[model samples]
Target: MLANKRILLIIGGGIAAYKTPDLIRRLRERGASVTPVLTSAGAEFVTPLTVAAVAGTPVHTQLFDLTTEAEMGHIQLSRSADLVIVAPATADLMAKMANGLANDLASTLLMATDTPVMIAPAMNVRMWDHPATQRNLATLKADGIRVIGPNEGDMACGEYGPGRMSEPLEIVAAAEAALSDGPLKGKRVIVTSGPTQEPIDPVRYISNRSSGAQGTAIGKALVALGAEVVFVTGPADVPPPEGVQVVRVETAVQMLDAVQAALPADAAVFAAAVADWRVAQAASSKMKKEKGEIPTLSFAENPDILATVSQMTKGRPPLVVGFAAETDNVIAHATAKRLRKGCDWIVANDVSPATGTFGGTQNTVHVISDDGVEDWPKMAKDAVAERLAQRIAGALVG
Candidate 1:
């Protein structure tokens, strides 16, 4: 699973740094290219020559070297890997990362790299259990850096607790998982998010209250599962997720165009709360206040993107999921919408004012399909997204 993957291994100063040479060997055995970065303290435990010999690559130990810098700049080195791993991530190193300090070469690389990062923490029992260390760990996790283990057992300092770094083989396994293309890997998926605006005039437009939180979460989940996601987003309160190709549009028509351009996907999830109608004859200029005069405006129906894609004769995705954000009788309305829209499934949710489903963080939804409706409990937007993505993966794999 780790075949041909590029790993930037940053070794921190710790007694566990000795285990990293074996970690590099096992990774190389699995066809991964291991690039080593040895910290000053780390070099005290393991020589650069030993690290280089095991990795079969030159070890990076300096922040500034004319010879290497001319070949590959620090920024390039930081971003030129599929993953960045910090084995024996010391308390000092973790603290630097948590506080965004980039004084040293290792910390600089960690701050600059856009690649995924994983850490194997090793420290003294008391240090590992310190409140400051715990807080830093939480911050790192929240930032999406994966943590392997600090297993409980004997420590090199002769103290017993959860301060030992995991064995080399176990760390290798985690690395493989991190680099592996998941079940949905190589699959292309289209996700539409947020609310479209229908222009009423140059200065103003009509739009929905969708914050795009649900859609952003869904995109993140899909990417985590290794899917190539094309995220078509409208103007929203929440920002889009990282690690996906984003296509931004303002109106329903523009969104449809973007979606059509990103076609030939394995699946399509229409989560955008697109405006149903648009001003047929909007004034070119903003209407000014006038006494005893009321301007009348006509409307035209906007394109039905979900229905149009669901019923495509050619190049239709294998799975088509539409969303029904209704105010009342959500299940009944969503079930009917699924059949009418000719979509494979409909995620139905109540968006009534009382429910706070428009721009809220949590959601209670039902998954409606030809089989039946599955009731999902209210949960955080990200949890809902993960469950939905897993279900999609199963359907696609089957």
Candidate 2:
């Protein structure tokens, strides 16, 4: 899919810089031409000669090289590519990009580029979780920059969390998706997945059995179809899919806010199994056992995200799809939910223990609409997502 594409790759100053040679090789294997830009810090981890050898192109490292400047200015080089990618985008680099600082070659190229940009972040767990880094990340996303991964794993720092740069193949897939001109090209979608956690105290919370598999699949499917997807997700067993804008939230209220912020999209899919209620007054600390006495708790209803979005008088998505996980009377309940929630369609599934649907790979679903219910045979969650994505594409593009 990336045949003959030009990729301007910026290698940041991080331990993950060692992987850029492999990333360059992968991009070349798929018929992409990569131009490497090595930061001074990046050169400490990987030699410029190695990068140049793998990419089969001269590495550009200096912002003010008199000889190179005469041949091609930084602005011209930046604008010459179809896409610019920053691998192992360090915290400092991200901060520079977010704050629009152009003191160096990498940041200068990033600031000058009109081509779409994707970054694969790599940092220590603490740096990834720091409020300042997260704030910068949010700023970058808001500016329409695409983020690949910072997958979770043991880092070079011997710590574990979400700060690992994505594997080379994953970055390739994301790059292809970013450059795709599929049926849903130019369309925007919002997909909510996973189960919201309602905190009862500092440690305990109320949640559900949602694994986020289906939602993640849906996000992937949409991206494959060339739609710009804003994935609003809660805590789930599954990680958010690559190549889509991911918004993480912990409660129904936060999910709603994220969804709304991602709006003005062509479609919105409410696939999350959000908690329906939360403790009205949760304890500040862990509730201790008190001599065989049960602690009484009051419940408050969570906001109905589907209903709120579906009933929007202005700026409502053209197509609003909601999911219903019914234990019994699947079609009956789901059909009623369609009318009650004021959505365009309802994807209903039986989540009873017998169905093994909730954390399982296969799913049997009924697509409920005003016309009637279409019972679909059991299939893998990925297949279901692909089918649903096709239908969404048809609805939006046709």
Best by TM-score: 2
Every model's TM-score: 0.59, 0.83
Runs off by more than 4 Å, candidate 2? 14-18, 73-76, 90-103, 122-143, 150-164, 201-204, 245-249, 260-264, 312-316, 370-372
Candidate 2 C-alpha error for residue 339, in Å: 3.5
| True-structure lDDT of candidate 2 | 0.92
lDDT of 2 by residue, 55-141 (tens): 998999999999878876898889999989999899999999999999999999999899999899999999988999988988887
Scored against the true structure, residue 101 in model 2 reaches a CA lDDT of 99
Identify the candidate with maximal lDDT.
2
- On residues 121-173, what C-alpha lDDT tens digit does candidate 1 reach at each position? 99999998799998898788657676666766888788897788878876776
Instruction: In candidate 1, list every pair of residues with a backbone clash.
Output: none
lDDT of prediction 1 = 0.88
Candidate 1, which ten residues in sequence have the lowest lDDT sum? 239-248
